[model samples]
Target: MPAALLKYALSRKYPARHAFTRRRDLKKRYDVVIIGAGGHGVAIAYYLSKYHGIKDIAILDKGYVGGGNTARNTAVIRSNYLTEEGVRFYRESVEMFQGLSNELGFNIMFENRGQLTLAHSDAAIRSFRWRAEVNQHMGVRSELVDRKTIAELVPNLNLSEDSRFPILAGLWHADGGTARHDAVAWGYASGACERGAELHQCTEVTGIETKCGRIAAVNTNRGRIECGIAVQAVAGMSSIVADMAGIRLPIHSFPLQAMVTQPYKPLLGPLVSSPHVHVYIQQTSRGEFVIGGGSDPYALYNTRSTLEMKETLSAAILELFPFLGQARVLRQWAGITDMTPDYSPIMGESPVEHYYLDAGWGTWGFKATPISGKTMAELIATGRTPDIIKPFELERFYRFQQINEAGATAASH
Candidate 1:
């Protein structure tokens, strides 16, 4: 063995650390108070410090950094959407992710292995056509592919007519792919800390106190913190956190579950999904088949996995790849999602003055982390919502102008 390995085997010695940040003591006040230290919060802090020159920020989380929804998600990244605004925003996000590793000085494990959304019915085929057209108009690399092309793309995939949902066509997206979820969070956290933003893990916000409508301070389990601006990015806990500031959001929380099969050789390549059957399958870098479906039947704020979802998701996966029946499932888990009626996130200023929102992420958040952070940072610095995020404003609900992405969002995230 090498000297490093021999030393480690004998006495568990390790090399010197590089640029890493640590949790620190909370202060009485900060220029900005960001709740939730997950990917979005950390990325927001990073962009604020790097781009806006606002470094006096604090990221407070009830749990350890990236231990929440950041790690729970499947880490799929794509920008093929139904709306022009959605496409533009997410395209910028995907572009940022393409160079994220170099910018953060951290390997985020971004695998650009493309994605395919299978269409099984006439309606699905038509929707795919419309979506592909829209995606193309917005400069997204998306198009409808027939069964013959899909077979050529993945030769081992099952396309037998005996299956209940026969393969008709697919929306092939060359830009869609996946990334390492935890690494993305850690990179953002490291960059933010290097820029002088503080991260306070295990620090939960208990209350949001206001004086005469403007921002005042936030009451946390550690201590009370006075801030001029308070931004909440608590994914599943959006409603509970916003209510503390007396602002109500149009969101319902539900548990979104997923599972992975035992490792095998690289059998799956691109991310595949069937909206008709509510199943999306992707092979991880470790050769495990990561499978997931729609949200749970009833809305609930829990992370507990269900056998019913497992069975349903498994059956759906088998319909597309019958050869996977022999592979055993290694693990299963769930993440809470704050779903919105329009299937779009609620960004920008809320009813409570000086309080910003990064809520209603639903299931498509991991893909939007960078863009959300960029826009949220710009919003915080300029006191105005960016044009890219204007369509997702909270007041849109009251104005009855919702950017609907239900058809594009329901089956997969």
Candidate 2:
């Protein structure tokens, strides 16, 4: 080790460097005002400043950066979706995630460990087959695998035929992986701030003022600031924020719970999920296993973890990896997800002119952070929606053209 490194490592107190700038004053005007300072919001600002040369941006968050759903998600990145639109969109996101660390000049700790979705019944087998075909047609590395291949891929998985839900087949997605959730948000915020975009933490958006059917200014707890464009990227609070703009969105908020086990010997590889049991499991690089499942059965805005969810997740994970029964759980938490009827995100133009929407991400928001940011930046900068994201516009709900992905998003989130 270098002498300076040794000295720093041995120091009693280490210096801390702030990734994003701290601004106390809000500007009177900006080219764009983005609500929510999570991964999507910061990524949008980063792309706007770096790609389109639009640096007059303001990112306002009610709390600290990346403190919402961005910090709460499990960080699974995959492209093996069912619908054509969903598959294509997430495929690009997977590709972007591969190079995100280098592009942002930050270590996001991205690992392409692949993902395995287990099938326990004939219906699940058929669904996996369909999704595999759709994914393959879109150039994503996804295929249906038999029990033999699954055993080779995940030697530790329970393959007992006498189990309640026998392992019939699986969907092996080689393009799937995971990354550090908060690091991604921090990287984008740092990059965007370096390029002159301002981030205001603890700045709450109170309401929005419009003039002639266009956005005029945004009212915050701090003060009101005029902007040419306003974009809402608040994940769980999408409907509430859109309501402030006098626009109603078709969204329902639900709490998704997850838990982490105490660090143990690394015994799991590849992300494992089973929709039949409604649970997913992945061991983090730190040796702690993350376990999560579908959203709560009811719709609510609170982020409270429940004992029932913990018991359900624990039981489901044991069904797939029986050896983990000895592992001790360290903590559990929850996040609010803004779900749409179709289980697909609503992007692009909204009913309010000059007020773009980036809402209804549900459980798949973190995986699409980069692509959503890039495409939304393009739309905001050029005043034209990109072709890649037009299919996800809010108009789809009005036209009854929902890109249904309920089957694809079941417990895989």
Which candidate achieves the best lDDT against the true structure? 2
Candidate 1, residue 342: the lDDT equals 90
Candidate 1 local Cα displacement, residue 146, angstroms: 0.4
lDDT of 2 by residue, 1-413 (tens): 99999899778687555578777699999999999999999999999999999999999999999999999999999999999999999999999999999999999999999999999889989999999999989999999999999999999999999999999999999998999999999999999999999999999999999999999999999999999999999999999999999999989999999999999887888999998999999999999999999999999889988999999999999999998899999999999999999999999998789999999999999999999999999999999999889999999987899999999998897
lDDT of 2 at 25: 96
- In the predicted model 2, the residue pairs found to clash are none
Name the TM-score of candidate 2. 0.96
lDDT of 1: 0.91
TM-score of each candidate? 0.96, 0.96
Off by over 4 Å in 1: 1-15, 18-21
lDDT by residue for model 1 over 1-413, one digit each (tens)?
Answer: 79977777667356555343565678899999999999999999999999999999999999988888999999889989998888898899999999999999999999898889998899999998999999999999999999899998777778887789889899999999899999999999989999999998889999999999888999999999999999999898999999999988999999999999988999778899888889999999988999999999889987998899999998999899989989999999999999999999999998878899999999989999999999999999999899999999999988999888999887667
